[model samples]
Target chain A: MENNNVEILLIEDNKNDAELAIRAFRKANLNNHLIHLKNGVEALEFLFGTGKFDVRDISKKPKVILLDLKMPKLNGLEVLAQIKANEQTKAIPVVVLTSSKEHPDIKRAYALGANSYIVKPVEFDDFSKVVTDLGFYWLLKNQPHV
Target chain B: MDNKEKTIELIIANKKLAFQNQEKEKRAHELVSANKELAFQKKEKDKRAAELLLANKELAYQNEQKDKRAAELVLANEELAYQNEQKDKRAAELILANEELAYQKELKKKRASELSNSNKEVDDLEKRVKERTEDLESFSYSVSHDLRTPLRAINGYAKMLEEDYGTVLDAEGLRFLGEVRSNANKMGVLIDDLLTFSRLGRKGITKSTVDMNMLLETVLSALNQSMTHNAEIKFSNLLLAVADYNLLQHVLTNLLLNAIKYSSKKEKPMIEIKSEQKNGEIIYSISDNGVGFDMQYGNKLFGVFQRLHDDEEFSGNGVGLAIVKRIIDKHDGNVWAVGKEGQGATFYFSLPDNDK
Candidate 1:
């Protein structure tokens, strides 16, 4: 059970939202390599292979990081800044997943090298569509530096 | 007689005659001396009379001068009296003016204090309104996320149920699921609109010179893409305005969309867009030959959640005009509508003319 081959790293605080996003990906048959971290600390800890994830390989980064803006302990923007600032993780595309467009950190997220931004829709169908579409475009269509 | 006396008494009487002659001579001498004295006295009297005459002339001249001096004094006294009267009049006017000035100063002081009090009240009111608007904004914003979170779950689960369990359920069950999804979606829109309405107070407007004609073109194209309608929107040489571009676009889109929807049933639904300059404002009017409302419900047209037509007749969440009103109000503009039952309606919004 190697966790090194993760593709989509979903960093969200709310359990329901995390499950829904996973479900949305699963519905689209794109949840094969997705990993869900409950908080920003865990995501960072998982990404840099530090503390609990020290033994894990840091080189095997996810294809895209789905970062939520509002979370407990080292929120999304800070996590994004750390990811973008590092030499090894800077190439990994980071997508901002926010609850509302009214989240004032929208501009700052982009400024911190977020690859894209998506507002989680209210309707499940639209939400599903958005999740699947991003999966398809980023995983299949978008080419990243190897 | 003296010679006879002198000769007669010759001899012895000669001596007596000589003595008598001597006495007579002495008497003559005394008479001569007295005559001389008389002459001298007469001369002295004549000189005294001349001196008296000169003194009399001097007295007459003095009397004449005194008379002239008395006349001059009378004239001077009259002048002094006139001057005193004038000075008295001036003093009376000065007293009246001083009282008036004091009264004016008191009035000015009172007015200044009143002005400051009202200004303070106005400042307090503005602060409260700002705080309340901010509260409402943050409330709606968070509610959008919080409410939508559960709503998404419900809608998603319902959708997942439909996709996964559609084969096991009846057709009625699928329809109910559809209803649920749509109602959730509508609630989402309503929440979004509420958020936008509250946000108007917090968002600062970035103003620019807007070409009305160009703005209408952009709006028409946008409206065309959003919904398909056959309403002929006409405008030419529309006036320009200095306002927030995006907010004004929002106002136009809502009004035009409403116009098209309200008039959809008409054979030839026509919408005329026009702009005119009036009273330091540029008023743009959108007239639609739609299923207009009774003029009685006109005031309610711009209220939040206020609808003249039922949901079945016109599909709307009743927030378009309210949004329009708020945007216009943020620009210090006015919005109103005039309609008659079943005839037509005219919606007008005016913005301050800052172009020139």
Candidate 2:
């Protein structure tokens, strides 16, 4: 529940896709202290300790943010721009995971300082594998700036 | 001298005086004659003076007439010289006009040749565009074909539900699973159609004499084995076509399959295949007494993913004709169709008779 202890922050609008990603991370034993926010608004609020997360520590940032491109309010790119613009959150690694490889947002995400981009596969097994691999890579393999 | 002589000889003088009177009478007669001669001479001189005056007046009148003639000649000579000058100026203008005409003719020649050169350039550009389009088609073909792997995986996982979770699933859950599987299968078919369509764009034609009779036999038998239909198929004396064997087979398969599919609703479906040689090309036709489409939308028949009939009425992803069109285009051939609603449809394609 505490923001300081969160290692993975997933901002996804689709409940089923979020569940699948969580299951993938759990299967890889990388879901400990994982936080799932339904939209970019909630993700931004949680990151900056505003709104519902007002009492949480603002100094603490997730090890990585898994962003989805298409969302209801405040899309992934906007959230990415905000994250990269802020001095405190700019150093944290952000990965973009979306359904289409041809999505135009992929380039923009990287341009906005996204560390990695992964296309979510249509098949459940491949999707699971990709999510699990990327989770492991970010949480364990990659060295955080903090 | 007579007085002194008279005094001395008075008596002798009487006889001398008679002789002198006689001589004096002779001398008077001679003097009268001379005076008459002188008067005649004076009359002759007066006549000569009057003749001289008349002659002088006539000469003066002739002189005046000559002077008028000389002045008229001088004016005539000056007018001739002015006319000569005008003629010279006209000759100079004529030379300039001829030069201008020659320059215009040369310019026209240059323009005509330039137009022809640009026309040839346009043709070359068109050829290059066709080559580039073929390359792009092949690239997309590979990309779409490679997309099949993930699609297959998706379908496989969706199908795995029946075997793995069949016991725990309710009817609705099973239906949902079926929908997912079917949608994945549909996507797979679409991708395959896209690949086929794109492949036709790049596939080179291998020309060979194909026996239509045998090809139809093989295609019909293969189709029959795959699907059952009470359709009467007919073909006779089919002409040979010089084309790529595999591509020709693909075209026939698509056409025949279309015929069978559309006519399936009829009580007795009839499909006919015919061929003829005309205009240095072999025209092949496939006719079916099926639910034909409206002729208005004929132009869109060969377009990618373009369907005239509803997906519910006919199950097609609409890429079959597009593939046919691409193949025919690659062969430098043409394909067209004629159809009437509820009557029948006939598809025709022509291949160049290079073998002949």
Best by DockQ: 1
lDDT by residue (tens digit), candidate 1, B1-356 = 58777566575586777888999999899899999999999999999999999999999998898999899999999999999999999999999999999999999999999999999999999999989877876776678778878888778788888888999999999999999988888888888888788778678899999998999999998878877888887889988888999999988888988889999999999999999999989999999999999988899999999998899888899888999999999899999989899998999999998844
By lDDT, the best candidate is 1
DockQ of each: 0.65, 0.04
- Tell me chain A's TM-score in each of the predictions: 0.97, 0.96
Worst 10 residues of 2 chain B by lDDT: B141-150
Alpha-carbon RMSD of each model: 5.7, 15.5
Top candidate (TM-score): 1
Candidate 1 residue B160 Cα shift, in angstroms, is: 1.5
Could you tell me the TM-score of candidate 1?
A: 0.79
Query: lDDT of all predictions, in order shown?
Result: 0.89, 0.84
Off by over 4 Å in 2: A1-146, B1-142, B354-356
TM-score computed on alpha carbons, candidate 2 = 0.49
Q: Candidate 2, residue A43: CA error in Å?
A: 41
